[model samples]
Target: MNPTPPPTIVIVPGLRDHVADHWQTRLAQRLTAAGRAVHTVPPLTGERLALDAQVANLAATLTPLSGPVLLVAHSAGVITTVHWAARHSADVRGAILATPPDFETPLPDGYPTPAELAHHGWTPVPREPLAFPSIVAASADDPLGAPERVAAMARAWGSHLVDLGAVGHLNPASGHGDWPLAEELIATLESGPALAPIGATPTGEPG
Candidate 1:
């Protein structure tokens, strides 16, 4: 008989280009080095429908996996993951929503405007608790979403909150390369009771 396969680590990136030194890329590489299967969604062009389509495609990608799946999403990726979970919660085991942007706030020029955010079906951001275990990590100084806003999201989603403290979006600009704490967080999810439906207690320092 074949040994059980390791869980797939789905890496979902945010908008625009995927930088080489970004923490997400580095984490993917580290997971790969540790013998995990990593699948990263291709960068979307930021079109409303296209982004929604990407969420649907994520469901398709998970359909065939035999083992549980874990999601590691950053920025807009966090939004995408939450939307995907609202529909396809059964397929995911856990998620790490790091530095998600607040759609209600004014975004930088060239990013999705408030009208576009609504048009793209990203508004009324899913606040319902996820069907699986999740942890929402927010930077204390993130310009995208205030710490309180992020914490509120975590509470609404029934997810544990992790306060990263001044790490801008937890991206490369924050100077967080090869985040070693990720492994510990991932391990926490993996070792959780596999059959439990409810999530674990909220975790991390207050954001």
Candidate 2:
């Protein structure tokens, strides 16, 4: 039999949106170079912080893909994916949510305040189980999200939590670039195994 086609990979950036050196952007370029179907959500010049616009943009990006799609979202993009998943579950095969920030709480200097996040419809992040299976990679030392909080989110979303100890937010500022493990997690999701049930213990990084 012919080999099954690979799923289209969607790169979802955080609020910063498409940083030149960000792992997500590099991953997209690398994957596209390797001949994979990939799509990225473009940055919105206006209403950049509005969660509704972000979700809609994600939806629009996915609307044209015809096969199984895997989402790789980081930071705020993770929140956007959950919000989109709450309403539309079709076509998505799986997702990898990395180091999602705790928007409900006060962030450190230079980030949006809790009130601003709420005003932009980013607060009260969706806690219900997602439409498709997913894996959440969380950092023990992520400033934006406490490890305990990230674990709770993973549990609530019924995702298998991959505990990445002390990886500060898994961003460029956090000293991570060309994150090789992202491809591994995406492969696991594409293999189609059921993720850990809601409330399971956080696990070491997935192989």
Candidate 3:
């Protein structure tokens, strides 16, 4: 019999698991239904755990996959994943970071302020290029991060940027209960190292 396929999708939810009807949950379900094994690591509270602990958790989750893994992270989850990638890029195949809050910029309304999180030792994006291919998706109106800053982080990490027009944080509040675009991007990552340009609209074209 054929060996079980290595898990292709690893869903890293932020703070807590995606709420009911959240887009991330939908994306996970859809990918699993499409014959992809989805691994959802339990959420890490950035407040209670040290950054190193968070990174360790992420690394632990990655250790079991036998093949290239497509990492899907959102919100604060993006920061944790990027930090992990900076030090452990060889373990990850590629990543899709959606609505990564600007860790260097002051926080805006309805989000954690930089001052509030400064005590946690939040660091700026490292200057080194990520060891593998990656993508950063941000909204034109993401309250957590400005578009220009997100683009800069993408550049720093050597990742392609996707400017999702006016999609606030790309969360449940943003009305994205079914994020088909994200599913397609993760699928693309599983197939190869190259990714489409930032502004190229993804048509959910299945691989």
Candidate 4:
């Protein structure tokens, strides 16, 4: 009998352009070394329409994969994944959302301002629970989000919350280059429950 193949791992970075030392990039390298199929979504740091296009692009990328998919998204990428999953979650098995920022609040300097964020359709982020199993990892000291807000979002999304404990943003500035623990988190999704579209009722419920 043949061994079961690993699911395709999709690495998703925030709206900013890619950086060499970003932990997500480094994680992709490690996954590649382990012989797992990995694909990183290209940078899409433009306005709201660009974000929508990027989500569509993600769908195109996953369409051809032969196995289940596990999405790993960081920062603004978490919002992207959420928006994407709202439309195309049937292909996803599970996801790990790390250090998601509170889009309804102010963001860090150099990122889009509140007006720009709204202009780009970032305001009123989706609060609906995801269609598949997911985990939302948050840092106690993340500047882009408050612990309370993250927890609230997690509850709204029906995702398990993971306290990372004062790891500021979990980015390169936070000294998270080459995060070994991320692999452990990803491993948890390997045996996660099967995918079920959001709002899909179980048997005996009216449609």
lDDT of 1: 0.77
Cα TM-score per model? 0.86, 0.93, 0.84, 0.87
Model 3 earns a TM-score of 0.84
Candidate 2 local lDDT, 29-119, one digit each (tens): 9899999999998988888899999999999999988989999999999999999988776688899999999998899999999999999
Residue pairs with backbone atoms closer than 3 Å in model 4 (clashes): none
Ten-residue region with minimum lDDT total, candidate 4: 198-207
Off by over 4 Å in 1: 1-4, 45-49, 193-207
Per-candidate RMSD, Å = 3.7, 2.0, 3.4, 7.5
Which of the predicted structures, 3 or 4, would earn the higher lDDT when compared with the native? 4
What TM-score number comes out for model 2?
0.93
What residue runs in model 4 are displaced by over 4 Å at the alpha carbon?
45-49, 193-207
Candidate lDDT values, in order: 0.77, 0.87, 0.74, 0.79
User: Candidate 4, residues 3-22: lDDT per residue as tens digits?
Assistant: 98888999888866778888
Question: Would you list the clashing residue pairs of candidate 3?
Answer: none
Best candidate per TM-score, number?
Answer: 2
RMSD of 4: 7.5
The C-alpha stretches of model 3 lying farther than 4 A from their native spots are: 1-7, 45-49, 196-207
Candidates 1 and 2 compared by TM-score, better number: 2
Which prediction has the highest lDDT against the true structure?
2
Model 3: lDDT equals 0.74
